[model samples]
Each structure stands twice: as C-alpha cells, then as structure tokens.
Target: MLYQNFSKTPVLAAAATSLLLLLLLSSTAHAEAPMAANEATEVVISASRIEMARESSGSAITVLDSDYLEQNQVQVVSDVLRDVPGVAVSRTGGAGAPTQVRIRGAEANQTLVLIDGIEVNDVASGSEFNFAHLMNLEVERIEVLRGAQSALWGSDAMGGVINIVTKRGKGSLNGKITVEGGSYDTHQETLAINAGTDDYHYALSGTLLNTNGISAASEERGNREKDGYKNATINLKSGIDLLDNLSMDLVVRHVKSDVDTDSFLGGVGAVDSDDNTETEQTSGKVSAKLDLLDEQWHHRLSFSANDTDNTFFTAGTESYNSQGYKQKYEYQTDLFLYSSLTNSDDLEHRFTFAAEHEEEEFYNKGFSTIDRDMDVSGYVVEYGANIDDRYYATVAGRRDINSLFQNANTYRLTFAGWVTDSVRLHTSKGKGIKNPTLFELFGSTPDYTGNADLRPEENSTWDVGTEYHFNALDGYVDLTYFHTDVTNLITGSGQTSVNMPSDAKIKGVELSLVLRPSDNTRLNSSYTYTDSNDGNGNELVRRPEHVASINGSYLFSNDQTRLTTGVQYNGKQDDIEYDANWNTSTVTLSDYTLVNVALTHQLNKHIELFGRVDNLLNEEYEEVLTYGTKGINGMVGITITGSL
Candidate 1:
C-alpha cells in the first residue's frame, strides 16, 4: 500500500500534498540553476571517488561545511546530519548511548561510514557505526550520499555512505580555543592549532567533554538516578611536499570515553547501577598523492588501520567483566584520467580505476563461539562525464570476494541534467549487498542461536528527482522519490535467526529546501515520507511515516551576532516490545515535536561567545521507544580564534 492509504492521517495527507506541490513547482520553473549563498562553487568526492562540482554530482548528496557546523553548535557528528533529507537517526539514550543511522528506510547496518579514507564500520558485529563518541572538534566537512553505493564502495553501502573529512593545515600559523558549560553539570574544552610552510604543514586538535546527564530511562519510568559521561578526543594531521608534484600525508585520530548506563530487561527501564562501559578507538591513515601530466592525471595510494577496545562491567560484581576488541586494515589505490571530449562542446570525461583489500580481526570474551577473523577483497572501475557544462553521467561496476560468501557483483548507472535553466532532473539505479555478521551466523547459546545457512542480504534501489533553483528567491527546492527491494533478509524468530521467505519493499518521497532571503538570514527545511513493509506487508519497526524539520537564523550587528530557531516533528512509528515471557509484539509510539534556539556574538577578532538551548518547550519525547531525552537544557561557551 504505497502512499495510497496516507489519506487516513491528517499529517500524512498534508505531507503527500506538499510533495505534489514540490513536484509541480520544480517541473515548471525556468531561469537558471541556483547558486550558493557564498557564490563559491564547492567540490565533492564520495560520489565516484573523483572530485566534481556539486551541481554535477550524480547522486543526491548533502554537504555540511565548517561554518554550518559551527553556527549550529554541533557537538557530535550525528548532530550535523539531523536536518538532511532521506536520512533517519535514533539513539538509545543520552550523549554516550548507541546511535543508529538509517537512510531511505534501509537497515542501520546497511550503511557504510568513513573517516577521511578509512572505513569505521565494525565488520565483526552488524557493520554499524556508533556515533556516540565521534566528536566534531576537528572536522572540516561532512558529505552524505543517499542511495545504493556498494557498486563503488562494496558491502554495507546498500543504504548510503557518510564521508567525514577533517581539517588540513595550509599557509600560516593559527589556533583556536573554546570553553563551554551547561546544565546537568556539563563542561567542555576544545583546542586546535595549525601551522605550515612551503615544505610542510600540520594540524592538531583535542576535546574534553564531561556531563552528569539525566536518566537513560524516561522520568516517568520511576528511574531517578543520573547517568554521567566523559570523553577525550585527539586528532593530528601532517603533510609534506616530497617534490613539486608529489605529496605525502598522515591522519591520526584517537578517542576514549566512559559511560554510565541503565539496564533494562523485557522492555522495562531499570534504575542506573554499576553498569558502565569504556571504549577506546585509535585509527590512522598514511597516503601519497602524485600529480602527473600537468595535474591532469592523479594517482593516490593509501594504507589505513583502525583499532578499538571496549570493556563492560556489571553491577555488584567486581570480578565479572566482558571485553571486546577489533582491528581492521585496508590498502587502496586510485588512478584518475581526465580528458576532453571532442564530439561534445566543452565537455570533459574522467575515468577512474581503483582496487582495495581489507582484513578484519575481532576477539570478544563475551562471545565464545564466533569467528575471530575475516577478509575481503574488491576491485572497481568508473567513468563520469560532464556534457556541455549542463549534463552529468556516471557508470560504475565492482566485484567483491568475501571469505564466507564467495563473491558478489554490483553495478550502478546514474545521470543528471538541466531540463531548463532553473529546473534539473536526476535518476539512478544500483545494486548492493550485506553479509551476515558473526553473531547472526555463528552464535550458539540457550537464548540465541545462529544460522550458518543464511544467505547474504542483497538489494536494488532506484530514484528519480527534480530540483528548482530560484535565483530570485535565493533558494532551491528538491523532491525525490526512491524505492528499494531487498531479498534474503535475515530476521530473528524467538531464539533462532533465519532468512525471510520473501522480500521487503521500502519506498518514499523526500522534499528539501534552503532559502537565504537576506545577506545575513538563512532558512532550511526538509520533509520525508517513508513506507517500509516486510514481505508479509506489515509495517517495519522504527520506520516513521513522516519526519520534518525547519531551521532559521538571522545575523545582526554587522554579521557579528546571530540568533537561530529550529523545530523538528516526528510522526508515529512501529516498534517491537518484549513481554516478561520473551514474546515479541508490535507497538506504535506517539508523534512529537521539539523546539530549539541558539545565540552567538563576537566580542572581538579573537573572541566569540555562543549559547544554545535544546528542547526549548521541554517536550517529553523519545527517539527510541523507552529511552529518555534531554529536556530544556542550555549551554554557554566562548571561542578564541587567532595566531596562537
């Protein structure tokens, strides 16, 4: 029942109507493609591993630059992505809790995450990324690509990809420092330094965060104890010009965190006790880039490694503990060839060839019967072209050889072009895959058992969209319709895991808008409508039918002061609830709305002050069924930017 039954709910009806308006508005517009407010063109990679202008990007992509992140006072990586269309985010509890990122209704594990050029997804688990500890102190930009990307990125790209690019040093010496404090006994400190000369450059940063947070469970659940969290992060980047045309660089990141948690069994929230967990992640990448043929040809070779260690302690048991660790390694090479097209006017072609080999090693004292090691190898080739400065096309294919699943092939074809000066159209289709995790395929215990016979989960996705650029209004609007079909989905039935007999279908429409009415005023809005159902036509869990967000900000005092307001609305969704007997049942959570506000002012060229208030209305809402959310909390801080 794809959108046919949305008339039953008033909110759904309104969303459907808005989608139609978006279609009509974009289809009829004529004039010129919208330009960025800064009037500066941006270059992006992640679409095909080759840099291209944003307007020529083949996939639906969103870029969050440093300025935007700063204006929003974003603390974590997930905060920067909450307003993007076609994406969904949920957390189990407070700041240090686990977070799940979903794109276009696909499962969380079906998404791939990258830091610079290194993949951060835990291969031994469900291939999911935990954003709780991923601070944003040193990040320069974040790129989010929505759709099936496995054709170029391999497994776990079935939903999409998130590429995090950190800051790099250039030119002269400079530094920044920030200190913040807020409700719930929260405090934070950040420092960043950069220095460079013609031959060498370096950037270094660190962050310290501590908070005596609210309860992990809802206040009404009779849980009164607080769960505190503390974390420290460090990032270092260095580059050297070995020769005029060749450069070498290294990126190192480390994070350590401790979190106090609440234990809940059978869908009930228990009070916080001695249940605490500590995690440490260390990752590094070393690479060399060579420019040949007057910078027309580019070659990059990189090697990266990521290691994580975690320990969990139970209440009232000093001798009982569980620990796990993972080590991942990757080697990659990319070669790009750029050439001009003779037949097409002012057209350019970029051909890319890439190869990768990765290995993952995991050990857990909590699980005794799981595999300890796995390996995968992949190869890819892609061709992308910009035709006559208005048309863009891309085609790519990949082959992945898995240790347990033998081999899989993936491919993609995408295109984008301007229908008129102001109206643009885009569409793409791709294939993706996700292999079974160690717990799903090898676990054997009284409460749960694995299925060695399970098949790899595979999917095909397609999307079409139109965008209208309103140069006069200084804004743009986009509407996209997407559909995904997945087969061999693995599910749990009681104590055992098995593949579903049929397939699941997820279809949705997304609408996004950005407006800069004045030189110092900006507004952003997005809406998403999703219909996700299982093979039997039952609504899937946590896939909300409607999600919307709107944010507006204005700068005064010659752009030295800024004030922002925001709102988020989340509609009802289905979730699973377990009874005391361990029986599972579906439940629908109520809809909710949250409001937030922020203020910032510059005291001088070297000093600035900022404050933020989240959940301004103190609305009691939950992203996860039973997890608690912060209410009516505020933070104030000052930033120092200058030559050290």
Candidate 2:
C-alpha cells in the first residue's frame, strides 16, 4: 500500500532519490579546498536547555533563521514547516483556520510548542497549540527538534518540540515598518523597534492583518459564501543587568483574532453558514539568572503564564465559549565539573539539574459546564561530556509527579562524533509520555463524552543519522532513519474517547541537502519516506507516505535584487469522511503540488520593495476533507528601516 501511494508521484520520488544518491557519491569525492572559515557554528538551545553546538547534539534538529523567513516572505509559521522533513502540516481551511502539525506521524497534541522557553499549548483544546495565529512578524528563528524529548521538556514532548525564539534588542536603536496588500481583500501592516545598551535592552513589535478569505467549505461543493479573518498581535521583550553576575529578563505577548467559519451538515460535510469564532491569547514570562563560582555555576529562576479565551457564534447568536490557563514556576542550575582548557586531560564534563511546578485550568460553557484543573511537578538531571570536541555524549532523566493519573519517568541518551573533518555521525534514543488532557477526561458535549478512565500515552523513539559537508559548495547533506512505538493511543470512538489496546508503529527516512553552487545562488531540498500503521493494521490519517520539497534563491542586479522559488509535493493520504447520517468511511485525498515565488529589490539603504505569489500553479488541493484551499494569490509590500 505504501509503495502504491509513493508510486503516484513517481517524478518527485525519482528526483529526490537521484539527489540523495548524488550527495552520497559526492561525499566520497576529494575536495579541492578546505572548508570556509566564515562558516558560523550553529548553536541549539532547545536540545538541552542550554546552548550547544549543533554538531555536538545527537538529536535530529532543523533551524530556520530570520533571513530565510524574510526571503520566503512567510507570514504563517506553518507555511515554512511544510518544507521540513518528517513534519506534516494540515490546515482545515484557509488562513487563520485551525491548523495542526504532526512530527514523525505522532498525534498533534503530542508535539510540544515553546515560545521563548515558555510552553504555550492550549489546555482547553486537548494540549495542542494552534498555528493559525502564529505569525512570523517578530520571530528571530525557529528550532524543530525531532524524536522523543520528555526527559528534558516533560509531558507533551512525545512527538518532538518546536521552539520559537523572538528577536532581542542589540546595537543601536533601529526599527522597521512594513505594509502589504494582496488578493482576497487582504492587507497587513507591521512595525518593530529594538534598542539596547550595556545595562538594559528592549524589543517591541506589533502586527495587524485582515483578509476576506475563501469559503471554509469547498467551493466546488456548491459553497460560495466567503469566510473572512482578522488578527492583531503585540509582543515585547526586555532585559536589564541587575548586578555584575545577576540579570533579569521579561517577555510578554498578546493576540486577538476573529475568523468566519462554515457549518458541518449531517450528510453534506461542510456547507456555507453564518458562523464565526473569536480568540484572545495572552502570555508572559519573567526570569532572573545568576552566576556563581567564577562563572562555572549558573542558576536561573523563572515564572511563566499563558491564557486563552475562545468564543463561537452561530447565526450571530452565542453558541459556546472556552478558556484555558497555565502557569509554571521553575528553577535550574548548571555546574561545569571539568573543562579541557582548565584540565590537563582532553575531556570536559557538565551537569544540569532542574525542577518545575506547573498548573493548568480549563473551563467551558455550552451544552455542559466543565471546569477542571490539574497540577504536576517534575525534576530533571543530566550529565554531558565532550572529548576533545570530537566525541559527545549525554544522559538525561526526568520524573513527574501528577495530581491525577499515574506518575511517569522518562530518560534519553545521545551520542555524536566526528568521523572526519567533513563527516559526522549522530544518534539518540529516548522515552516520552503525554498525559490525558482535561477536555478528554471531563468535558462533555451533546455529541461527545469524556472518558475519565483514559491513561497517558507512552512513546519510545530512536534515530541515527549522518551529515556530510562539501567543502567545495559550502553546503551539506544529511540523512537519517527514525522509528517510534506508541502505546495506549487515545482516540475517539462512538461518543466518547478511549485508549486503544494495540500499539502503533511509525518509522521513516529523511534526506536533506543544501548547496551554494555559486556565491549568488543557493538551493535547499528535502525528502521524507514514512510508514505509519496502527496496531489494527490501518494507515494513519493525513500522514503522507512520501513528501518532498525544493527551494532556491538567486541574487542579481548588483546584489540588490533577489528571486526565490519553492515547490512542495504531498503524496496521497487517508482521511475520514462522514455522511448526513454520521456514517464514517475512509477516503484517500489526492496528491498535490504547490509552487510559490517571491521577488525583492532593495530600493535604497533604508527602503525595500517586495512582491510574492502563492500557489503560483493554481493547483486544486485539499489538506483536510471538505476544507477549502486558496488558489493563486499575489501580494506586494514595502518595508522601511531606520535608526531612531
């Protein structure tokens, strides 16, 4: 079955295979010159809760920097994620619609999302973070760490972690203003400012967006009413040096959104309707860091909170509302036991200890009034060693004490080493857990019931990969194989949710390549082959067996003009469909290909102009059954940057 589905996109598959073979053969070729000196050492913070060189971490991670976001003209964060290997994105409708991201075929709720080190999953919605309102206006970079990670992040890390880091103030006072307009009566305006000094620094940004989107229901299915969306967001980050060894930082963000939606008819799936939803979210964090023992020991104390409120209206009448709140207090210390530079041996050792207490509350008002709260405490310990910067190893463990359900313990082990100056090998093995959400345990509605007997889902995963750097092209190629076993899968059956008795299996291979054929041109590409099945021998829904993407950028006209292009392919996948009688049947959604292009020109030192076209090929596709997707759309914008 997987082979048949993969064969559907023979062209894409063959191209990806050819590229993989080419890179593999090139790895054995001798380079004419050494690696570039300016090749910056990429550092990852989410992999271990501290900064570590990317090559030193065994986890499969991908980092998308701000420059990439700007070059791609990305507005929604999910748009960029689709290009990542082993990650899948599904949107129910158009922009601002409900969106879900799955990693390694794991459930969406099992993927942990972090914003500047603060968890932001929606408790009222089953511990899932909606990417609908996650714009890239103020984002500095995004780190997608794959595989099981419960040992470091605790619950909801069964799939992986996506950490979003926002920009911080630095250098002189500077800012930028951007305005854009496009098809579907869409327009957006954004402003950002940053300033920093030796003692204090601050960064602030705001964005407003409005769009008369397409119908949430498929237009081809006789739905013509247009659904619209509106959003407003604000973010602020500041830091102050309290003392020579002590410093404090604060971050706050707020978002408000309104989206029009369609109704689901019993036998007809989705239809035009007078329905809408409004959501408001606020999140904040404060932390103080102290250094002791001549900077060998570091301590951090922090508090963070996230709140979300959502209301739905049908035919302009109140229907239902929900609210979710979460707060956490945490303390962590890192002790440097030994360093190669300080000791005579060529080995270094470090230890980290952390403790956290978190509380979550969920409330709903509709057919049934549901209010629930849960708390958990967690402790984590980790040991890491580096031998002459050629070999690295880490062992981490965590114990969680929960107010409800069974207590859980998880651990992870990782190893990475340099095989040659241009080749590296990395691998990791880990266990993860996801506790049942309050909505799944207590909430009840006319169409569904909660199952308090639900147990937490458990997952075990492992991955091994190799990276080869081509000194001639100033690029690299990476290949990895990963597998996961999931037990006690929580799923909906009839009117209530239940944990399946069978274990699910997911395994995949990922291939990625980067090449700078010339100083003026660069290319990036990735391919993933996944095989996912439930214990009952059924393929998971919405998880394509084969996915591939290619993106390229070119600079010309005296380095003042840039052109970027991207193409993505998604293989056929299974989905569930319901009729008027609520009878469900499995269906295969057809494969699709999307093309996008962008052109930007630096008008001057302080002014820039850009234009972008999405769905350039106007391909008709459905990411979710009965959901409408936009056709070819275009937008033009201008940006102005200056110092205050």
Instruction: Name the top lDDT candidate.
Output: 2
- For 392-468, candidate 2 gives per-residue lDDT tens digits of 89999999989897889999999999999999999999999999999889876545678899999999999999999
- Taking all chains together, each candidate's TM-score versus the true structure is 0.90, 0.92
What's model 1's overall lDDT? 0.77
Roughly what TM-score does model 2 have, to 2 decimal places? 0.92
Residue by residue across 369-485, what tens digits does model 1's lDDT show? 344556676777787776776888999998888888879999998999998999989888999888876556665443466677888889999999998988877878999999999
Question: Which 10-residue window of candidate 1 scores lowest in summed lDDT?
Answer: 1-10
The clash count of every prediction, one per candidate, is 0, 3
Clashing pairs in 1: none
